[model samples]
Target: MRALFWLLSIFALAAGLAIVARYNDAYALFVWPPWRLHISLNLLAILSVGLFALLYMATRLVARALALPGAVAAFRAQQRKQRSIQALRDAQRFLVEGRYGRAHAQADAAYRANESPGLAALIAARASHAMREHVRCEEWLRRAAEHDREVRVARLMTEAEFAVADRRFDVAAERLDALRQGGHRHIAALRLSVQTAAARGMWGDVLRLARQLASHRAFTAEQAAPLVRRAHLESLRELEGNPEGMVRYWRQIPKPERNDRGLVRDAALLLNASGQGELAAEAIGDALDDNWDSALAELYGRIEGGTLIERIGQAERWLRAQPRDERLLLTLGRLCLQQQLWGKAQSYLEASLSVAPSRAAHLELARLAEQLDRNELALKHFRSAAELTG
Candidate 1:
């Protein structure tokens, strides 16, 4: 529509000029010093218009020629940027495809092209690590640190993980310490620290990190159970020489873990050895209350001191509920023996034998006979105990 308007305007102007030209005949004379020339005014106007059009075209051509170099530079820059983006994308794809060599190549190209240089370098480093090119991996990590300071957290995390993979626990620990000092204690970093600490046999750190992660719901109960249990077991061994330390640690363990039969058994044995019979008995009593195990009942009898009446009463109560449990009866007998109630001890041991003639029951009866100075009965019980292969 705009083109049509301009076209009509041009035609109208031409017709007006034609009518004017037709109505009047005009001429102009140009005189040079030596010659004189005559021309029409309309022709002079046409000549001036033609000269203006030629000059305009000439100026446009010159301007285009002068701007050509800058235009070409801008075009090349755009092309490089596109190539760099493609390289970075291809690198990520190759990394996911497990083509380490190709991923490293593409990432190197991206880095050289300066497209997200820090990210490119880290990608190359990961690929190198996968390929077992340790030197190259370290070099790329160094380049990553140099290229972008903002990626310090990422670089340190990567370095620490790779070091852990290599079993260079000390190096991994150092990297993690540096990361913590830099104040990047996100869940992922904490998880990595857990792995590193576990690898280095740093059970203390493992326990601390596991608890922290658990609070954040970072792992489910099923997933965290073994980790927490292992940490506790290791920590137990760590405090082997410090009985008070063991006591403090035991009390801090959650109630559910304290009810684990296996854990309670180990803990009881350790506590007994450390002269903490009361706590040991308490732990055993708590575990037995949760779940009955014959082995734990037997272990209960072996613990000698620490509120003997309480432990005896607890065992007798369990015996009331499980009258035929030989191990529980034997434990009752042992507890009676500890309190010097010879008649009760002998009676319980005999009842245990009547229920199930086990070697442990006979052995306890034999010990009771000796305590009461019945040599013939002690000899008979000893011979009976010798026949069983317990």
Candidate 2:
């Protein structure tokens, strides 16, 4: 299409020139000292136009020649920019592919080229650490730190992670504390904080951080359960000697978690071990009220505190709801035994045996039989208990 258009244009121009030349009755004369020259006006016009065209072409060529060096410089700069970008990209890929040595080299190249220097240095640091080049890793991390405005937060987080991996909890804590000073309790940071706290035996912090992470949806309930449970266990242990602290911490825990069988058992046992058996009984009773756990029911029979009659009454109430529950029947029988209602203890124990036999119920019956001086019956119960244990 363009060729056809140019062809028509050229033909139009030639035809117009032909018409002008055919109608040319005009002339121009020029006189010199010894020569006179005559020229057609149309001819003169053609020559003048031809000369202008030559000059335009010459000007364009000179301009291009003058710009040559700068153009070459620009082209080279663009090539370097592309190379730097490619190096940065390759470094990241190598890091992901586990090519630590190559990653470090490429990252270093990127840093020298000044392409996102902070990110480049951090990549180098990570690669160095992966290669077990501790000295080089630290050096790269320091270099990354120099670009503080660009990656201070990233550098700190990376260092904290490395510290945690090395079991340097104290150092990890220091780094995490620095992050906190900057108001960064971001999800990832909170996760690191959880590890640091747990490793340092800072159970309270572990609980707090785990809860925060869960709330942020960084962990699913199923995933968070074990962590939260562990933190509670450790926290209870930490307060083993401090009855008040243990109670306070227990109350501070979310009410829903108080019903967790494992956590409730641990808390109760710890309270009992610390000479706070009354609190232990209260915790167990409260947990049983919220939700029936056979293990907790069995534990309830052993904790030596609270009003024996009240516990027996509580067990009776649970019996109405779970009549076939052997653990509850056993608990009721033990409570009755403690209250010295020998006949009632005997009846409840027999009922528990009918529901399901347990070593605990047999042992309780053995003790009751001994109290009553029934030698043969006591011997029978003792043998049963041993058999169940075996």
- Total clashing residue pairs per candidate? 0, 0
Tens digits of per-residue lDDT for model 2 on 177-227?
A: 999999988888889998888888887787778778888999887777778
RMSD of each: 5.6, 3.1
Write one digit per residue (lDDT tens) for candidate 1, span 1-390: 999999999999999999998876788999998999999988988899999999999999999999999999999999999999999999999999999999999999999999999999999999999999989998999899996575788888889889888989899889989989988898888888888888878887887888889889997767666677778888888888898999999999989878777678888888888888888888888888888898999899998568778788889899888888888888999999989888888888888899889888887888888887898989998899999964
Q: What is the C-alpha lDDT of each candidate?
A: 0.88, 0.89
Sequence-dependent TM-score of model 1:
0.71
Question: Which candidate number has the best lDDT?
Answer: 2
